[model samples]
Target: MFLADAGVPTVSWNLLADLQEMWAYPFMVNAFRAGAIVSVVCAVVGWFMVLRRQTFAGHTLSVAAFPGASLAILLGVSTSLGYFGFCVAAALLIAALGRKGRDAGAEESAVTGTVQAFALASGYLFISLYKGLLEGPTALLFGSFLGITTGQVTLLAIVGAVLLAVLALIGRPLLFATVDPEVAAGRGVPVRLLSTVFLVLLGAATAEASQITGTLLVFALMVIPAATAQQLTARPGRSLALAVLIGFASCWLGLIAAYYQPYPLGFFVTTIAFTGYVLAHLGRAVHDALGRSRPRGRTPLSIGGAA
Candidate 1:
């Protein structure tokens, strides 16, 4: 068949040969799955991240994960495991430290920033301590989908499912807490605990995402989609759903572009995500303009973006 002739195996003989061939490879299949699962989790967690104004936490946990990854490489273990372990530890530390003060302000974030810097420096130092320590040592921090294995894909699936469940179980309470912490506390919503839980999940999500996009570009996976959706729709549920869709689209498209283009995969994904955010902003502007030129007291489509 055409697919076989084009070096791709497909159930349909007449399918696009080159594209089918790409999927015939296990590595490609694993990369696609891992990237997809991680993208969804990141998008979901990122919604709260934006609402709670905790993008800094996302950034903090990612860099703090570096030391664990570096140590994993030196100790002959999976970098993902190392990264997860380290971030969890840091999350616990942050929670404890932040709880000590009555007023949680820039001070907590400043401490997180300092920890992040220390972790990054430690990672670099560990890497430099040994020669030929890795095949592509930097890939742990920067990401390389080309290197994903089936086992890693399975691991991502498990982690993604667990994270999604946790997010769903606490979604409503978290939303309430994020929008109005004082009210949530007054209503006995365990505001502090909720905040800590969110931060922990965010750290885990960041570690998973960083494996594909690197620590530097994890924000694309975490922040951009939710942010774009918020700009387009004002409602929490709608924005969250749209953010997931946008994040998924960006992942698949970025993967394809990375497959074909010479640039790093993260670059393509980041560009697409940024573009989506921009378009959303523009769409908001147009909506405002049309509303202004309408009848008095016109009912605008509730920006809530939900059905």
Candidate 2:
């Protein structure tokens, strides 16, 4: 069975030779290009999402991508269309329906959870409605690199660039709003508009990530690397850069591993990210235990947050 599932005929002794062989194919080249774009975009957006404590909303958007792709398969259209369209629409709905005020977080969670449940049901329904076997989009549920094209790579690059530019334009205020919304509002920041805009951007990022990591495992890129980086460093810039590095490494290594073996790509990606997170957590714990010579300023878990 191991032999049956191998993508390459044999393991090679030479690392550079194996890498050269992996990159020799146009499909592999496109996969790398797309993965690079997705990794950077998702990493940046995910860092802010984590800081804002909006991971539940991000998870909902990722889940929403599934039904979108499912409907596209039923309509015989591009799955990318379904992925983008549904995620954004669901985000708008969540933003609109979720209550505002002191209880906003609790209300938003309820709305996000409801949308996630409905999205899952709709995806299954779309799958069941297809008369023939749903082969194309189904392969993407667990992630695959098959049929990635230069055009798709170009599209991903354009989307990634746009996301980064928009984020740059609003990074400072968004950070203020995220860490202390009340104070940000008192300082004349448009907290509500920023929240809505961030949610939409998050949905777009989630959709983009789904193309590489798939609908079910999109959080592997969207959350794990950012969370791991936050665990290691509290500084926003360092954490953001570290998240991108972690995400990029995981994406490239997972692609290489999947190229050598025929196992599902999402499994490799998620496992690598998860392992990094575990290691970071352990290191943080050890550092906390060994330091007691002088009193150092504590890094707050979050604003007014306890361990």
TM-score for predicted model 1 compared with the true structure: 0.88
Show model 1 residue runs off by greater than 4 Å.
Answer: 1-15, 99-102, 133-137, 295-307
> What are the runs in model 2 whose C-alpha is more than 4 Å off?
1-9, 135-138, 293-307
- Residues 136-247 of candidate 1 have per-residue lDDT tens digits of 5556656678778888888889988999999899999999987878888889998888878888898899888988888778888899999999898888889999999999
lDDT of 2 at 222: 95
Give the CA lDDT, 0 to 100, for residue 191 in model 2.
91
Best by lDDT: 2
Question: What digit string (tens of lDDT, one per residue) describes model 2 on residues 22-71?
Answer: 78879889999999999999999999999898999999999899999889
Residue 112's lDDT within candidate 2 is 95
Candidate 1 local lDDT, residue 253: 86
lDDT, model 1, position 17: 74
Clashing pairs in 2: none
